[model samples]
Target: MSAFPKRDFRASMTWLHSWAGIIPTLLFFAVFWMGTLSVFDKEIDRWMQPESRYAGPPIAYDLDASIETFIGAQNGVEVTSLFIMPPKPREPYLYFYGVLAEEVNGKTYSYGRFVGESNEMLGEPQSLAGSGFIFPFHFKLHIPGNFGYYLIGAVALAMLVLTVTGVIAHRKIIADFFTFRPTRKARRVTLDLHNLMGVVGLPFYFLFALSGLYIFAGWFAALPMQTVDGVMGKSPVAFLELADSQSPKRRPRAGQSIAMDKAIMPFKTQAEALWSERYGAPVMADRVRIEHYGDANATVIVHRVFPGRRVTMAQDRIDFDYATGTVLYDQQATPATATRSWLEGLHFVQFEHWPLRWLFFAGGAAGCILTATGALFWMRSREKKAGAQPFNIRFVHAMTVGSVTGIMLATGVFFVANRFIALGALPPGIAPIEWEPITFYIAWLLSFIHAAARGRSAWMDQCFFIAILSLSAAVLNWVTTGDHLIKTMTTGMWSIAGMDLLLLLTSALSAWSAIHLRGKARQRPFAVQGDDPALQPAE
Candidate 1:
């Protein structure tokens, strides 16, 4: 009844790993690549938004003054909540966001404005470019609604299964870790690379997949909560209230007799004093969230900044009664919540440890390489089949080349378009924030078309295109902003300079890859069979 013997766990797992991974691996690659880029998201934000750039050191600003100005500028708009994000090392500008009381067409929306150290508004163009694009795209795939969340969650579950089965299938995983033969045939080389990256980065891959699932556990599986509710004979709302009793509660505004400025200033002063007394240092508020503004039940939550100390960002917080400026809650997270926070932090790398963040990025890239090569290896293995290439095989090959290299090319186009928008080269109607994604999708669609038309040559052509576009982005930045690499280095503008340097480095690597692919293409022409002596496996 079974294709393999029941006793052969390895064979069964090998089959499971191969087929289970084939389809989802493409999605996994996109997620890994985008997630890797998101590590330096704040820095990229600075690169794209020149108006928010600050060349000098971090400065302390008056939070009260900024808040007062922001409120005054609201022009009688009823704001339900306000958030103030202070400047940090990479993000050197204060940001103000307000949630409006009224919804736009039944959907609630928040408005944001950038503030300088002097508490003056910096009218930076409101665009969801740079890190904003890549960050959400990583988890959501830019898909609308909760469907993207569920879809990515399913993929994460599949990845978890693939990791477990992969471990079982590779019995000699340790040996394979040290066994890559570059001189072997193309298929062997691809397989070896796949094995090497997978084996070496297995722990990272497993943790990321597991943590991602846990982070979205609610969306992935509601049965656990449902069971709890059923057992207790309680509604979901009541259960949620019990679970989140420690969190701040939201309430409607009471329209009490309290001046907005008077209500906010005392809380700011007390929060700073309390934080300094507790941490033995002056507290720079990373974030200040005020809910139910002007209401008797209003609450203010102050989140402090402490970088590189732990995995979790904003672990410390102080809550206050908005009207009286009295401390309401000053408790740390419970052990259970702390553990969950740590896992979430590990996945996000919100802590400011540069070296560890780089390690995460490298590991994520390794995971992408592992997926890409696995697909390539599968395609190569089937190329030796006797009959004509099957439709499924061709389809997989087209998708492999298109999605893999297409993403890179599209990313290049995104950078170039960012520069064009910033320089006002685009049409006035085409907003920078909106056009960035538009350009990316158009380029990506064209890449798929090219892949379908050119077959194997698509790889080389896309790589070459990526090289040119990458270099162009760096050049464009310098020409438009007059912030050349040498000037940025001399002036200590590391954020912009670092991004430019990385772009150049990316261009070089892409060019090298293109040349290497060209040589390989010439040496072994595209074929559906490995019967040729050149395609023979190395002994």
Candidate 2:
């Protein structure tokens, strides 16, 4: 029996899958890769920060002294609040980040998310304090927020639809369940792997699609209700109230700079006691904030990131009155908040032990492989279906290769550019754009041009380029940062050096694939006669 159940079912579903995947395949590849990278976003930040390798534990510091040093280093700087990062996977550096108000070119400016030593800022400013390209690349290709979210949501919904129709089209679902006939050429090979991987990972794909949509669900699904509520004039206040419910309230004017360290002591004591009794654990304190400086009723808030069952990675905000040093609010979260907390923890891998984080990392790599294979499958299928339509076939083929491999190549180059650009080795006038889309665009555009020119040879050529460039970037990082693989591993500086070793491993894989593709392309071509029953496999 056909999996499609009816003639129209097969026709309609085939139509849906083909068209849905065609329009967004390129964009989808980028989204999948970038979003995966956001998992280790902070590690990328640590890798880019050369000094972090030598910095101490992220939490073992006095907040008052750290803030004092940071503020004193920048003359006339006012501190709004500070975000303290806990010790990462293998990095010991405690990072203190804050915003600074400054006047640049006669215009008032606010600089955000700056990293510093106890109080000393770095000599040269780095782009967005090591956020790299992952965060913005996830939703937008650095596009405007409004347009980007809607576009991404649409793509995700299309993917959901594609997954459903795809399952319906694969008739030999269980018979070919574990079969991957890589020996077959082009379409058969591509189709087999595509269907196999897509069907096997179908559940995960659907979960990710659904979760991603829920992250932006309000935009598309609840539009009319949102509009109606907005028109009623209660939405703004409701939104603010929701935000306030989560955020710590601002302290009133205390009329003096009361000792923040003293104010936080009470909350810290209470929190430590609570954690020891309820969770039977030790807590790591990150930072404490004193809001509304010089105000009479100013409050102090202490934030800690600790390991616990309820909120495996929890941020407990303990508020205290600045003048009285009295505990104002304990702010313990509910069971539902813990569920949200766990989702966040799982998303970032923030509270994971080493084994779990590595497991998550492996899963992320699988996703990347899945994306690259899907693109390759598209190319091979088009070659079989498109005989006389050579130009259209080549166009899609080039795009598939260009976008998939191009992203990998560009990521390597971006890391290389980070080191070289800092030393003024690149050309002048290459300052990063406000949103930094141009760099990725230029790299991707060059890949398109190269792929279009090279035709069938593009895949092997790009793979070889990626292998060389990736290794080259790793070498360059070692030269500049002195945080190469050997030293980093030996010194327990895993984040920076570990990333380098991973790149080297990736390079090796790319090199092997390139060699394989190059050899395969040299084989003789075959064109099957449609009318020859003998040429067709036994049905």
Candidate 3:
């Protein structure tokens, strides 16, 4: 049955879009903001860890040396897997990551270390920083286990539905693309801005939502897997083992340690040549993985980093026998696998193209604006219907103010906390790596409290606070690291310099937004109009 009058598909869709969007707008905004930042998570890592600013890729590119260093550092620890990631265009330091057999509180953990060009350990902060904190937060919001993944997957599904309904509802949304009236009434302006952002960013928003859902298809498949398992009397573990049996098996470990130099010689000599010949480009491996390092059947997998390519990070791989360096298996993606890889690449923006990365960032920001404004529009329309705002309206108002402004404040706090943790200025017993999320949650909670207590002024207050915190973070980096913006830019250390510049830019933008919000609050009476028009769409 039609939700509205017959032939009023637009009206029905409008109602569906509004309610559906408002339901998950805040969560959607958080995902969009974090996902956008994650596009440059590696650059952010370089910014966070100043010791990693080593100009460019190491000239020697010694995988064996890095692996040896890692093994020495974590002596006596049984490593389950070892990965060596050599520096590439965006990442300029050798990174050695491994999964160890050691269990902490019944949970296994992974450790990553940074290696300088000289094959020596670089003392960088032992924090997740951007890649660890921000990137995962994008998909999971740091929710423990599969819950976060399932939550994000649900949100992605909702986003897809909302996008479709929004398109159907906004019959003249294309016309609104070129029609933005800033001087109009608050309600009209918010509506127009929301339409503008939604229409302009439709393609990006749609693809992001679809790709995100596709990425987490495993979570969505769990229920069906259980059903199939129950019907077939098969366990997931057994299925996994059956699948693994097709791959190369690890032989018994040899008592004597394998020669690292001899193991990687084949990769260093012929891996790149093979990849370049196959891909028709001068592809070079940036990462290598060695399984069963000391075992008779050790395997070495080399991964190529293809920069400035399309949204398909083929990352061509070739596996070799550790002892003989003979080709064991070359990863060749099937058509369906290649399509999936391309979609994943599109969402992650792994290809090294700054312009495309910036465009994706902008599109994500626009999605955030769209979500925030949509929530505010609902509040405004509700207020217009009733002379006074109800409990639900006020609650949503506070939530909108808290979440939208709160996240920005929390991000600023996270950056500042990173610097403090790096300088050892934080209080005792607070591990720098763990303190990031703590500081973020604390700031976010305070924003909610301030939003409730201070009412409408909280937006302006938090914006101002974000500006201060952002500026302070930039200044702290300069003071602590001595990597001033001017010096970094002059020396062509863009990783650090670009981050500092962005922080300052964020500060300026926050200050401007705070001032604008303050002016708007003063000019417009809180209850002058029946409509609330609580928030403005951001540029």
Candidate 4:
């Protein structure tokens, strides 16, 4: 039945699967795991900052008043950006960004977190309310702008290709779907896991890759189209011009300011009315953007859309004059923009409810497991032949342990560092925001080196490391936040205490695997592949 000298389809796939699975394992591991935790990104911020506890009336002060007071408080301060918050369940803090000082003429005071009404610091100054570092590293590792994005794009493309090739090469899709022949040598065991996870998580894996790639499509895939539009007949500028042409261009006077008291509710209602008129049906308003602060002619733009629609498809761009608060420009989405809007919406998961978010999180975790198991299969399949190729095997092994076990440890370390730095246990001069990356990288590097030197024993070493890191993360939270497992359960502070329980689970699994592995080592080599004389070396 086969055309090649590899004989059986299974044998041919053995060769193809090794390379396909191994090549992108580490990159995908980083992507998937980070994405999993990113689902709870906001929760991580809440857990880190203990002082944000409040059901107090939402701060409804005048926008202009807050801006002027904050500006006056800091001489030579410039507000680069500001983010206003809606009445969300987790964090109701209105965020402000600008240069400021803790002391007059002091070394550019870096309290970026303590922002609110009249520049009156809302929460504790030393709290870790903004864990901005962890979320970004999950994608491109924050390598200056588009570079990280391109790298992720490359990996996503590889995932697409690998999935396609893997499906074609496998002949027993249905049979392998439920199979896990762990006793049939190391190679069989590895192959089983790779097939099982890959098959089971195929839909999720494809969506993640495709969606992730779409997010960067503008940078990589759509660049040529953008370039063509820019160069040909002034077409590129049409979209931006379209948005700007229909939107308000009114600039407010420099000195005058007006109160935006209860501005949000009315703005939302009116914007909805305008959209309903345009679209021939009602739509809900999502976000409000206030522009040109400290001016009489300032405008507010309200975004209205269907509740489950993508961000791009919103009947967006409604403007109102600040002084008279009269509607100026109201634009609705055309049928042509609907597809782009829907794709953009699908990519962002903007319409996700809490249940949907958790489901997304579960999908992300399954992707992580799928990637990890794929890497493990690559290593185990080559265990015997790789004996002569120690460094190559070691490198793969290191990546396997480092990315799989090491990242878990690194994440634990990150939370631990957050607790220490947030509680003021870490010394001064150490920038709190920068500490998360430093600790995570340090943990990753240490695990990589440890995995290389220790060989198969690195698994044990990493298991122990993970066990320690997970338990320590929980313990640190208890010590710093005064919230333990029982208290967290009773009071519903699951974010902080649930993180600890996860660590305990990780520890238990690692401990059990380590003991089993140690016992199995005496019978034969811990992981040995079949010795087939005809099996050719990797090309």
| Decreasing lDDT order of the candidates | 1, 3, 4, 2
**Model 2, TM vs. native:** 0.82
Model 1: residues with Cα > 4 Å off, grouped in runs: 1-7, 103-112, 218-252, 263-266, 272-284, 304-308, 313-315, 528-539
- The number of clashing residue pairs in each candidate reads 0, 10, 0, 2
Runs of candidate 3 exceeding 4 Å displacement? 1-7, 56-59, 101-114, 218-265, 305-308, 528-539
Q: How well does each candidate superpose onto the true structure, as a TM-score?
A: 0.88, 0.82, 0.88, 0.79
At residue 121, what lDDT does model 1 achieve?
A: 69
Tens digits of per-residue lDDT for model 4, 1-539: 34345456655655575576677677778888887877776667677766654334444434444445545555555332222333334454544343222333443222223322334545223433324555666666667545666778888888887777678666678767788878776656656776777787787778768867765674345444444334332222233323333334545345565554434456657877877786677665555555554355556667654354333546576777756778887676788877666665654554636677778777877777777777776676566656688778878898888888888778878777777875666666777756767777898889888888888888777777777777787788788767788987777766655566767887788788777767776676565646644333333
* Residue 315 C-alpha lDDT in model 1: 59
Candidate 2, pairs of clashing residues: 58-94, 69-119, 70-119, 253-295, 253-296, 254-295, 254-296, 255-294, 255-295, 255-296
What would the per-residue lDDT of candidate 1 be over residues 440-492, giving only the tens digit for each residue? 99998898889888888889999999999999999998898889999999999
lDDT of 4 at 378: 64
Q: Tens digits of per-residue lDDT for model 3 on 1-539?
A: 54444546666677778777877767887898898788889878887776666664344566666677777776677765566777677776666656566754333433455544576765435667788789978997876445677788888988888878888877576566699889777787777888888888988888988888876673345444444333221221233323333456434456556655574745755888986787698776766777666666677877664445667757466878888868877775567677777777798787878889889988988988898888877777766665564777677877888778898899999888888766888888987768888999998888888888887788889989999998999999999888898898988878788788889998999899999999999998574353333332110
How much does candidate 1 score in TM-score? 0.88
Residue 231 deviation, candidate 4, in Å?
23
- Least accurate stretch of 10 residues (summed lDDT) in model 3? 231-240
